[model samples]
Target: MDITKGYSIAYKGLKNGTHDFAFKVGGALFEAYGSAEIMGGDCDVEVKLDKSETQLVADVTIRGDVVVACDRCLEECRVPVDFEGRLLVKFSDEVREYDGEILWLLPGEDEVDLAQYIYESIVLSLPYQRVHPEGGCDPEMLRRFRIVSDKEFAEIEDRAGAEPDNTAWGKLAELKERMEAGPQDDEK
Candidate 1:
């Protein structure tokens, strides 16, 4: 991933303190990481990196809106997104994987590309349903859905009602009634 020059910060030269970085994201940014559900919109990312002697602590906050396809209507709609997370970067001699979140980088690594991570965070923050509010949905699409659902439900109910209720128990009841009457005149 190509890290935007403005988004990268060299922490080695900075004094031990908290530094703030901001980024304005759009469709172009999403394109850098393959095809994304977010087509267009503006999003703001605020990253606060707390530099310490041996470790770097970063608090990332992302907020704004993104255009995504609605699950129900399949129409593009803008959805607000907000996410907050923290990451810890530890300096180490050998490249080692510690769990999943913690990243180990060589002591000499100059800068880190946060673009991919930020992109993933935004995507992960999306809701599973991805639908517009009830009243906000497209009226035409909603009407069509209601019509189809109602028709399907009516068919199911009709089929259920048409089924005969003459179970084995009902047959046994008829048999018992015939026995109580001793035998039919025809049988006699």
Candidate 2:
């Protein structure tokens, strides 16, 4: 069996009704796609397809977890995934991609490939900032980060109050002031 072929739904053979299918994606699937965003995790995808004479509507629910680097501690972490999405498949004379949610199929196309959509849905469901739950990360890492960050913050605060005239920003400010004043002697 083709490893990636499992992702294809042969809608042509099915009668007009609702069909349910489940797929376990990750590991080999991720490797097959060579996706770096989600290297390893267990993702369960449930797809409910409602087929009619001319079109098919699929309701996809993705649930599971994916591995990512923690933003706070920089350690590996598992982020839960739970999201619902819709895909509309319509047959047309010419194949055209409408958007992420809509797919256009050619008249003789026999199946719709869903691997890309499933991958995207799972990846997009991840948090923008991946971090372990509060107090869940490595305590030592957190402590070290806190120490370094606090010291850096203190340095920034110390420098915040003192503006050096030799800096480019200071020179720009002086130039701006001079430009705004524009030969002030004549105006006075």
Candidate 3:
């Protein structure tokens, strides 16, 4: 089936009442929308449309999982999505959108496409910083990062806590003095 076509609500054909629609969307849907932030996902969308003489109200609920790039490891991680959004469609002389939540369409318009709305609802619902739960990153990458991080920490601590006379040349001079005084101390 053509998944993209299902997002349109044909209010003109139906009488004044409530209607229900369901759609299955996944990676292909995002790709078709040319979305770069979200590459793929498996989401079930349920749209409840209430049509009256003057306007239409749509309540959309999206539930499922999305595949996103993990912030820490840059690997694919599946994140669960559960979002609910509302949209108001009003009939006006000219077609325009306002406040991103209201859509105005001409009186004679037969259908309103909701593809963009669905995409935005799902995308905005995602967390700003996407990552795995604590310690869930790739083992190899974490290990390498830890090794480099430990070396950096050691260097920082050494510089912050070391005394002026504790430098490499100072340490060498102290070792030389100790060697010169070793035999004299043993004889005493």
Candidate 4:
């Protein structure tokens, strides 16, 4: 069965009252959406839908962990997902777009498909900079992708300026010197 089908609610026959719903989100959902950033995850989605004659108010809460590439190490890192928000489902005669806060649907629709909303919420809940905690990343990866420090850049700039010739070989020689001198023994 399609993973997203579990997230749809058949609410046309329901009475005017609040209803609770729960759905499990897994790597399949991400794969279905062809998400490149989210490698995999296990999340729980809880929706409290208050239905009435004209609208449905949904209180959505999502909690789980997603696996993505660490910003620092490029290795798989698990990031926590926690999102709580409200979704107002409003019925209209004309077709309308779903804004972040509200979902607009035609009156004839029998089911509300929440797969897109849940997927986006989980993705959005992730931190802008997803990375393993300090000292948690693989040391080898860290060393491989280490960024140059300000002191190192300044030293290189100073060396380049000190050389009378502003040629490409001058810069290459300086870099070679730094590399051969080793990481800690680069002074002087």
Whole-model Cα lDDT of every candidate shown, in order: 0.76, 0.82, 0.81, 0.88
lDDT of 3 at 24: 80
Residue 163 alpha-carbon offset, candidate 3, angstroms: 45
Residue 167 in model 3: shift from native, Å? Answer: 40
Error of 1 at 15 (Å): 0.6
For candidate 2, give the lDDT of residue 110: 91
lDDT of 3 by residue, 11-124 (tens): 898889899988888887888778887879999999899999999999999999899988887778888899999999998997576667898889999998888888888889
| 1 against 3, candidate with superior TM-score | 3
Alpha-carbon runs more than 4 Å astray in model 2: 143-188
lDDT of 4 at 25: 95
Candidate number with greatest lDDT? 4
Q: Write the residue-wise lDDT of candidate 2 on 1-188 in tens digits.
A: 55678899998999999999999887677777787766688989999999999899999999999888798997889999998999999888975876887888997999988988887788788999999998889875664455345466456445645656565434544665688787778756
TM-score winner:
4
Compared with the true structure, the alpha-carbon lDDT of candidate 1 equals 0.76
Regions of candidate 3 where Cα sits further than 4 Å from its true position: 1-3, 145-188
**Which runs of model 4 end up more than 4 angstroms from their true locations?**
147-188
Residue pairs that clash (backbone atoms under 3 angstroms), model 2 = none
TM-score of each: 0.70, 0.73, 0.73, 0.76
- Model 2 scores worst on lDDT over the 10 consecutive residues at 164-173
Instruction: Name the runs in model 1 displaced over 4 angstroms.
Output: 1-6, 97-100, 143-188
Residue 51 displacement (Å), model 2: 0.6
